[model samples]
Target: MTACVTVLIIGAGCRGKHYSCFAVHFPSRMKVVGVADPHTFARNNLQKIHNIDKKNVFNDWKAATERERFADAVVIATPDRLHKAPAIAFANKGYHILLEKPMAVTPEDCKEIASACKANNVMLAVCHVLRYYPASLKIKELLDAGAIGDICHIQHLEPIGFWHFAHSFVRGNWRNEAETTFSLLAKSCHDIDLINFWMGDKRCLKVSSFGSLSHFTNSHKPKGAASRCLDCSVEQTCPYSAKKIYLKLAEKVVNMEFEGGATAAFTMMAFTERLGTRKTTVYGTKGELFCDGSGPVEVFDFCTREKTVHPTNKSTVIPSQLMGHDGADYYLMDSFISAVAENKPSLIQTGPEATLQTHLLVFEAEKSRKENRVVFVETRKEHFP
Candidate 1:
């Protein structure tokens, strides 16, 4: 375990390259020994950067799994639908796994992946990178220390800027639910996970959600709009014109009522101007916390009638390429590498069980949205196997 933890990259896409770059930053702690990506450019890109041998490079995950395990762990950064098979296959091969979020498209597939890792005695860490952020960690610490007393309610808003939504959800890889999954699972699963994390052990009892592909559908397409934004004559003035970043629009809202009467309402939007911020408000018995997802967290203590600002960690030097999610991407891989190097799963806050718990929450929320009714949360004792 003390030796460098070598990783095999599956799907050399943005996330695949992002996690593997941790080896570049801390070569002594980790190493990238192999990669599996269908694209020749992506595969060669990783090969040139990591000096991976030709034999270790694969056209796809199936080819990688066909060989005996060559690394300590495998990073499953495949698309949402492609996650299940490789995750289960690698886990069966006894490779610790760093799976991307929303483990799979379906709850059954997610459970099966978790079961495979558990049966093989291989560790699984889902990429819930939000939990690794300094700001998020600071929030968790203050809540755990009872800085705000018993939690009563939380209002969380993720204003995914117009450009971001158009690029990723409207025109990019995650556009269609048929291809990937719903916006809730594809985009905001981690946000729900963070809220559940702040709730600590308080189980979510009832969940109700309301949202849809309201504005992003064909019905909203403006007159004279062409299928391709560049070809459209009205592209310049149309809000959703692929050529221009549109205005901000609220996409969905998920409301969860936890066991202890604590409620959380999460609002996710895509049409708003680029806010680049997660606005959060936590109201507790004794006080409240207000955070703009950066700088300092403000806590208002009712007893003292005073507001105190707690500054978050800001000294970590993040590389420009891997600065996604406020440099949280670096810390997530760092924790995963350390856990693998030390043979300790405890270091990973987003392990299979923890992620599965919140993933189920997300599924339920989505279910509630689609069914147009409240959904009661369910937990199974044998979730792993």
Candidate 2:
């Protein structure tokens, strides 16, 4: 019989929804036994959507971990600030962890979680999903094959769509810098990881970044605009009106599963209701990749002096037509499962190498922002070792 790992899901939000989808897709290897969330509505919605045993659901992660009811592993998908407590609680009990990124809001908290997981001899995989994408994997392969030839400076930008930025950073959970780190930590961590992955063991020499609420402040608010998009006078004219772009996309976007046995549509709706845009770009010496969450994957290769557009592969069960960023979701989940089954570290993300690299970027960026000087990534001993 194939050994099945029973999994517990923490947090009933967006990431959790995706993880639940993963559980459903790979039931032979993993089983989602229980789910917990502080918000009753979110938890109930997940339970109903996944048809989870009501008795197995809990309002608190601590309670679920204590009982050891339904899992050998726990997926932590809570907000940036809430990661440490549940992660540590379950790790101490010997539960393997799939932790969502930014790891934690602070470097100290990140260290704590890393230390706890290490002490318990549990596998701690951070959800830097982009590392799992096929395009990124292909990029890594090309880089390994010397496609880029000794990487030089990289220029990466996350085109956080205007409306998406407003919804998440300005009015949503990430709006306050204190709650989450800067937009770099909250939004660009994936890019940082990808840069590190492509940099191929090269330490980031220096880091300097400049960004602010440049487009979403009171000064930029349109005339007669209300605080929320629903009531804004410019709703019809605004490109990011919640109802126009995000809500419409939410309904049309493909549905997937996540950690807490929640559905993707539920979380998408929440994001649209809360924040309204998404787009990210990563540039390298050899090539550049761009994803707008609603289009084909585009790559510009300097070596070949050509551009390649990889259209969405739509024949799969999930219907690639609805898949975002050329079905990155499918590719990422498939890679993670393959890595676990093969008992090997992932090449793109989810390993100490990639995690440390990105965290170093975050650390230096925060330092640079505070000191108003460029900061460099310093090579350090592996946190896990």
Quickly count the clashes in candidate 2: 13
Instruction: Summarize candidate 1's per-residue lDDT along 1-385 as a digit string, tens digits.
Output: 3789999999899899988888888889889999999999999999999999999988977888888889999999999999999999999999999999889989899889877888899989898888898778888899999998999999999999877887888788987789989989988998999998999999888999998777877787787888887789887787666556433334899999998799999999887775558888999999999898774889999999999999998646887766888888888888888898898899998987888888888888889988999998875464445
In candidate 2, stretches whose alpha carbon ends up further than 4 angstroms from where it belongs are 68-70, 223-237, 240-326, 338-348, 382-385
lDDT of each: 0.87, 0.63
Which 10 residues in a row give candidate 1 its minimum summed lDDT? Answer: 241-250
CA-only RMSD, every prediction: 2.3, 8.7
Clashes of 1: 5
* Candidate 1 displacement at residue 222 in angstroms: 2.2
TM-score of each: 0.95, 0.77
